[model samples]
Target: MFCFSCCMPQDNVNQEPSTKPYQDTKPLASIANLSLKTDSTRQRYVAEEIEKLGKNNISADIFTFHDLSVATNNFDADNLVGEGGFGRVYKGRINIQGKDEDVAVKQLDRNGFQGNREFLVEVMMLSLLHHQNLVNLVGYCSEGDQRILVYEYMINGSLEDHLLNTSPEKKGLTWDVRMKIAHGAARGLEYLHETASPPVIYRDFKSSNILLDANFNPKLSDFGLAKIGPVGERPHVSTRVMGTYGYCAPEYASTGQLTTKSDVYSFGVVFLEMITGRRVIDNARPSQEHNLIEWAQPLFKDKKKFHTMADPLLEGNYPEKSLYQALAIAAMCLQEDAASRPLISDVVTALEFLSPQPGDP
Candidate 1:
């Protein structure tokens, strides 16, 4: 069990004191100044920002810290389910709209890579976006220095847990389940690219960010790094390069110019992972096979060799034609030229064809 709170800094006596509260009339300016002050003040400013943005849009609850604490049994170690760069996720039951429901509570680590800025970004993004393939944000807690987010609990946890297993007793995802997950994830990305106003680029699209429910339906989670897509005539948004290594698009990593196609490229890597059941980066493997793409690239040219790329754990159970088509989509997505990458909608269409229908052998 991963405990984020246990990793918090114990000594805060030397921290700077909070400055005088700024007027709400200029909330943006006030937030800018507040962000430079004490951590507590910054968290308060984040809460204010969330309230302002959520005035007309957000339906998520503004949960009290005490209530969430009680819900997670004070974030007991036994409740811990997952951990990330942001912090630990705990499985808990909380009453929402007067009904008992299971939820995953993501408590922010004061010292983690994610800070108040990422916290605010996630709240703003998830509050406005809605899709079956995207994880639902139930509520959040931003009191004092504690920043926590509550989401609908995913029964199967992340795709990474099932795909890259270390336990010998664990069952690998069946071919049908893998295709289902791939299709679901593609639809989620398609929604972000085509449905949302102003569009959204899911900057972080990795196996770990893909969560699965009890039915093995995949939902994209962790929108802290998500950015608004370019508008009007702008072809791309220029920003600092940020995303997990091995999953980021080569062009975005090199130029810092981001577009919807960048996400397409990342999805390609994930698609490859699904087909091969290998980590993007693995030092444990032979040096020639350290990177999944570098090793798989040569195999893409020869259809006969595609079988070699199929997860050994599958034991040759998947359909050969389905495997070829899936690999074709993956190759198209992994194109070196960002312009060559197909739109997410195209990817979705291809995946829909690949997914098996009910009662298919």
Candidate 2:
């Protein structure tokens, strides 16, 4: 249910303001510095686009600011689940279809990296794209300068919460759980790359963006950075480099020539993280191991060293055959040459075999 991505730089994480909720629906002062002309233009654009979408009949509900305020108990501190450069996500409850249900309310910061355009883009993207592995958008609140998104509350929080920062009392994800997560996440990417109209390029694929339900089912979240894949004869979508630091593909980082393979490379990094239980970029580790891909590139070349790359926390619990096979999939995705990387569909097919069968246990 959380919207704050843990993949951001530590310094960029803003402390939530302790101010009381506003009694009226007025724009926040944070956006005051923006020229009225600029703000008007932006709002006009979003309004026009929304009008167009209304003509086509989008399914997402348009929630009022007052309704969401009451839902989140005036954005109570206790309900805050996650926060990042984008904004804070709060756990709330609202009546849907006449029954009360839990939801995650993501309130975007007026001065944050996510602007009006990103907010509209997210609302549009989630409204159009539906998949089991994609987080469900219940509605959004775009009153004044306030930009908020309401989504189906995932009880388990983000995968990063369990995988990279699990508390001492909590157990790490088991081998079976990891494979299941990888397979489900891969299917989500496969759907985006293969099934969606015009195909979607999940430009910001990373571990922190993957949320988990009570059963540990993974759902991809935060589509603000998502873009339409190249159409027709075009092979790549040219855009400014804008993904998380460690997860961006080398070619895209340098050239800004984005393609579906860029997302595959990012997926490779996340898969490697899940397998090894290490941050993609950890300065605490030795200089040689600071960069996960660099450290694993050599090991990927030698099947004999694959065991060494496994998460120490796994304690040799994974099957030797599965570990090698999983590493092979990761290796192919991490290929420096984008053309060499397996299509997301192919990756999904490879991971499908790694999941345990019904009678295996």
lDDT of 2 at 312: 81
Superposition error at 209 for model 1 (Å): 0.6
lDDT measured at residue 30 in model 2 versus the true structure, 0 to 100: 18
How well does candidate 1 score on lDDT at residue 59? 76
RMSD per candidate (Å) reads 12.5, 10.8
Which residue pairs come into collision in candidate 2? none
Question: lDDT score of model 2?
Answer: 0.81
Q: Write the per-residue lDDT of candidate 2 for residues 181-284, one digit (tens) a residue.
A: 99888888887887775778999998889999999889999998888878799999898899899899999999999999999999999999999999999999
* Local accuracy by lDDT, each model: 0.82, 0.81
Candidate 1 C-alpha lDDT tens digits along 1-361: 1121222234322211122221122222332353375754666667677778667546789888889888999999999998888888999998988899999999988764356767877777777677888899999988777789999999999999999963778889988899999988988888888877677899999999999999999999999888888889999989889999999999999999999999999999999999998999999999999999899889988877889999988999998978887888888889999998888877776676667655677
Q: Ten-residue segment with the worst summed lDDT in candidate 1?
A: 14-23
* Deviation of model 2 at 201, angstroms: 0.3
